[model samples]
Target chain A: MTGAPRRTIAIVGGGASGVILAAHLMKVSGGNVRASVIERDPRIGRGIAYSTELPEHRLNVAASRMSAFTEDPSHLLSWFRNKYPEARDEPGRFLQRREYGQYLADVFAAAAASASGSGGLVHIKAECASIVQVPGGLELRLSNGTSLASQIAILATGHDPGPHPDRGFASAGASVPPIDCDRRVVILGSGLSMIDAWLTLQARGHRGEIVAVSRRGLLPLPHGEHRNPIKLDRADIPFGTELSYFVRWFSDLIDEREAAGGDWRDVIDGIRPFNQQIWRDWPISAKRRFLSHAKAWWDVHRHRIAPDVHARAHEAIADGKLRLIAGKVSDIADRGNRTADLVVRLRRSGDRIALQDVSVLDCTGIIRDPATGSNPLISSLITAGMARTDPLRIGLDVTPDCAIVNFRGEPSDRLFAIGPLTRGTFFEIDAVPEIREQCQRLAVGLVG
Target chain B: MLTKKGKYGLKALVHLSRLPAGQLAFVGDIARANNIPKKFLDAILAELRNAGFVQSRKGKEGGYRLARSPSEIKVGHIVRVLDGPLAPIPCASRTRYEPCDDCDEATCQVRHMMLEVRHAIAEVLDNRSLAEMRDTTNDDLDLPQLQQA
Candidate 1:
């Protein structure tokens, strides 16, 4: 508790980013910073990722790495024990993401209640339609026809599953189109999103045939215990090299490590800290090459899921209820029928697999193009020339410190972004460990 | 086969074709808007500029704009500019023909078959203009998925 809080930071979404940032800001500023979390969704902490009611949907990361505070490593496990004492609280335990959501909301509440300074949390249940810079700060227009003023605005609007065409196809597809529990369902993209759909369907007692189609037919690897991240000097890395050369170097390193009685996971975990730096050092051409050629491979290796989830997917495959195809859905035809027809073109064999009279679920991926994403706030930011998509269209363009860059490539002072929205700038972000550290750093900067 | 470069070029052209006449768009904006690589798009736009498809200006407001009316530019023409010929084989190409090292010029079965393949591809592509491509919505593409069934 310090002097009277004069500044209020308006966080546009009440997801993990908004809550975590609010907590960090309060902690760093000694409760001298004020923030209002504006979330259109009813829940204050769930966001899109953690809103699931299904017990089967758990966090991909373990409890040990899911702490909200950088200073407290055991915070998540402690909170989990208090909230659900019957459940196991092992460090490696993967708790339900919904519980994590509850933990976040509770943390923010506790911080706000105990703060002696004017720092408090106010959750506004309205969508931020747009944000514009004012003379001294920023103005936010909400969907409820109300406006908000704050010293700074952070766009914490989390993952969008692309445009409206992708409606009913989000990975957390609870309210999707009606489909028989025993009918065939074809899911596009065999990545995390596909795994999510598989988990959701299995939770719903779905016993039908599920065909997963992807460019490479790759699945996410599972998490394990033995984590030995290697330390590397800056000079040792082939910084600013062509993508192929970097890939070759990494491949050789992996081979050498595996030959020396080590696991490939060690190599991936070893390079985790340097992933963003390596990406930053590359030229636009090299970055493009990585995205086009190595992104899928990298994604599977880096973003591993829970071991139980991996086992269930494989079990389904063994039971012949799930099918994996190394192909792409070239077209989805809806003849005003209940089921859409998908013509999947196999990549290797070049054979067309005609999936007839099956429900089509597009779990292709996250919102790659932020400018055209489903969120009106993002498009409004772009239209107002206050923000722009990154060169890759992966997310909103941001400076390394998470400042939103305008159309002319100028980073804003009062306007900022975090969470998955800043993925283009911080490639290794979106996970708890990375985002938590980022929030702490950003909170320090804002408070200072 | 349309290379990724060609797809990107088409996407860029489609984006440009949608812009109001004489209105300019920076290469970076176009690249981000259409999910195209910046350097690759820069090169493609330069080729398009040289082919009289787009015009570039200099200065702060400098960027690119469609030179000819989108309707005046055919899809086949842009593909040829960005991705060589529409024909499967060089010998079958009408504008940029080159003899294949293995195939005969006359009465070659492969060339004859490829000539028909080239004609079939050109018949559709040459008829469609950039304007048509621009007008084709994602929903319109969905219709063919049913027609082929």
Candidate 2:
């Protein structure tokens, strides 16, 4: 062990994906790699999703399937069992989001401790302001006025909290205090985040009527009893360049499954394993068509809610406590006294409905268009020509291995993007299972 | 969460639950009446029998019957026996309580929310016996309605 300098990798964003990559790197490299995780937040491991303290914000995926390591599928389950021996063995149970965050913290801590011999994992609690390619490697300008140079850098920044509505509502302003219970609340975009907002309101004992509006006004389907698992081969999917043919094939598959007394979820889950491959194979036009047409339908089915949560949501809808409207918010007017009036164009009729005196929460999922996002680092990278958006303007363009492609359309060997930032390259890369698998492979590739 | 096996098992049990006391129903009859595959129903009944929810008799009078009177058997027990647990998350299960790892049990909002769900489900499945469900005749177990007063 005379004098060889170990290769150092810098991970920006100490979120779930970032920590997972660090943990896997330490494990695979066996303390031979130097790792530094730079995060803006004081807490590492808890990303925007898992950082929530709200118990109502349960994991969308079941505990049995949420292991951090792909090799040890039951790692999380075992952790739960060891920690909470009395916790019942519910195969489909959705654990609290914070608990999962803690589990990740534990994993990171363990990996960091074991890798202490070889430079160890450095937890830099500072935001990376910009990343620039230097002669030997890359240098990261951190927000805390310190800079770090590494042989390689990874961007695991996760999702951006979408762009604000063009016409800002009064409640969208920073000065607006916590929403009062009696004030009518209107949530824009009916997706998982919208559901989280609803759950939050319900948990907070908000008594006002809640209205969630989206383009299609579709609520996620509730998770039912686990059915027989369906496996699909590449041949089973209508692999083609034509979007229409694929859509027809998918529709027929769902119909057949339903006719055969199988749930539509079986078909969706079966296709999930192949989503990225299919997305990669599609022509740009086909991809655009799917995004405009089928993305919403796919989202609601793919991201289902727990049955109990679904029952409460259904009850709320039935009781008129929650109203889901299929429409577009054409305009929002900020009235004085923390209230906003919104004009919603009904989807079916094209007629506009004026919703007066409501608090609007923008839960429109993630901001896919990186150019319009509020992240300074991402903006800086784009401006510096270090990173470029995909053709669809959804996310950063990268090769299959997630090496960020520069303005010149060449994949960078030293710069990598993981998690939601690489969504354009891997369609289903956001979830824990997908991200974990990607990190495992990425760690091996980096070290080897 | 009810598994497919649990759903099929419940459907078969409901068929048998509707039978008059001392009467027995064959797997084929239950399968045909419920639109469940015969082989599936057979396995479901075998599971029920093993779980002590039902008792089977062999020979010319071969069939299955609830171990206890249908009025005394709760849907929750059958579901728990077949489907695993009534909790959407394991932390909320009263019968099988395991504190979630890294969770603050006292303050966990998820567990708190799920506990309500577990109770809601138990209220319907545990409170309503097989006899009551069989007597309803509507076939659609109005669970959401059942939660209402």
Candidate 3:
């Protein structure tokens, strides 16, 4: 085993996923692997999800489950508490997402500096425009007008935001004009992004009316205290049924669990481990049914907000400052004067309401259609017959082992996917706990 | 955008429209008859109940029935409640109007064309009651678009 050739692994995206994967590869391969993280952002681990400088944006999950390594669940909590001693008292604190992003980058850097083959890891700050399969490895063309070779290239491209407007909208985590504080804000979607933007306004001392609208008008439930979530057995989950049957069964389970003195959060967290399995077991029809009929409800219940943020949001509502509308936005006519008229169709009363003179924020979150993930590199790959979208078009098509599937229906061992890009294959993989586990598993396989 | 929820809700409403006057049908029966998912129908029916299109009773003998006669309920209203509007774009709808940002509200040809389309659809749907929707044959209807939806 001495002096064996070092294997090169290229991760195209230096968000939390790529940073975590790089750290895991270094730890697993000892001194025999070289990994490169390609990203346009000079700041590592601050991908689209985490680059938010806003102090209000926080981790959706609790501190206990947010470790970089699945084996060491308490690493993040310990690190956070050590950094901010005030956090020692709050065991379930949902820290600012920026803090978590910084922690991951710190850990990744530390791992690289202390590794036996410390020089093997490199962070290349450039965009990976395209990749091609070479004879014995892979070749990645960068936007900086250069190319590099690697034995394995994993698309850690992070969360694809889909098609977005050039401007005229405020988004969560993004900095807006410093003094637009007193303007009425009309948020398009009432999901987590809406909360982030609202909180940012609050932090900036905004006192204008904020109206948030969505089709269902559902706000994410707040995270609650929990000990051990109730464990679910494989037999208990109704697999291989139509989504309707599964939904009904799950609804009944919720009732029963509540009646028996169990928190609904327990039921959700209990089924956490099996989400991917359940997603896989369902037929394509069932999958489509769930996406169309039940995804919103599942998202609200599964992805909850921090308790403090929840209380503040409600307080704003009670103060008559924040208004939530359950309806649809029909049109936004820009008056060409910074203010726009947002026409909304009310779902409850079939009424058309126009919200005028309001600054707009499209907080609808990720684009509903995964087919819109046709970025330059992904588009090039599809055009070159290298990779394709999954059947449901949620994300990249991948095998059970996370290998990318090409247009000819062949899984390429050297090309892989992780994080949100692999969501079609592993439905619950967007969160930190699941992504860490994916990185660990893939690192082991890559090292082997 | 006719979502699955809207499609299922429409089918369920149609199923209720065909029932004997004052007759109540269990959710399972509605699901089976219409081939709708029982779980999905459960939510759709609950929404319909809130909208006062259907009233559900609690007991084992109790079930769901239309809150009003099929003739009194407009298909357009049902679609508006479940989906949103008949207009392909929001700026074009009579019931839900908004202007596109890039085009002038008074002069956009696309919005005008879409307004005509909305009028054409509303003429059929708003005028046609749930009874009419149920009575109409599927032959002349452009149903493939609905299936794709």
Q: State every prediction's TM-score relative to the real structure.
A: 0.73, 0.72, 0.72
* Candidate 1: tens digits of C-alpha lDDT, residues A63-96: 8888998789999888888888787567788888
Predictions ranked by TM-score, top down?
1, 2, 3
Error of 1 at A88 (Å): 2.8
Using lDDT, rank the candidates from best to worst. 2, 1, 3
Q: CA lDDT of A204 in candidate 3?
A: 84
Q: Tens digits of per-residue lDDT for model 3 on A166-241?
A: 3345344344445377788887788887888788788888988889898999888898866456765443354444
The interface root mean square deviation of candidate 2 comes to: 21.0
Question: How are the candidates ranked when ordered by DockQ, highest leading?
Answer: 3, 1, 2
Per-candidate clashes come to: 0, 7, 0
Angstrom error of the Cα, residue B142, model 2: value is 70
| DockQ of each model vs. true complex | 0.01, 0.01, 0.01
Candidate 2: segments with Cα more than 4 A from true spot: A1-5, A162-177, A335-339, B1-149
Which residue pairs of candidate 3 clash?
none
B88-122: candidate 2 lDDT, tens digit per residue: 88776532457878979988888889767876886
Model 2: how far residue A244 lies from native, Å: 1.3
Candidate 1 docking classification: incorrect
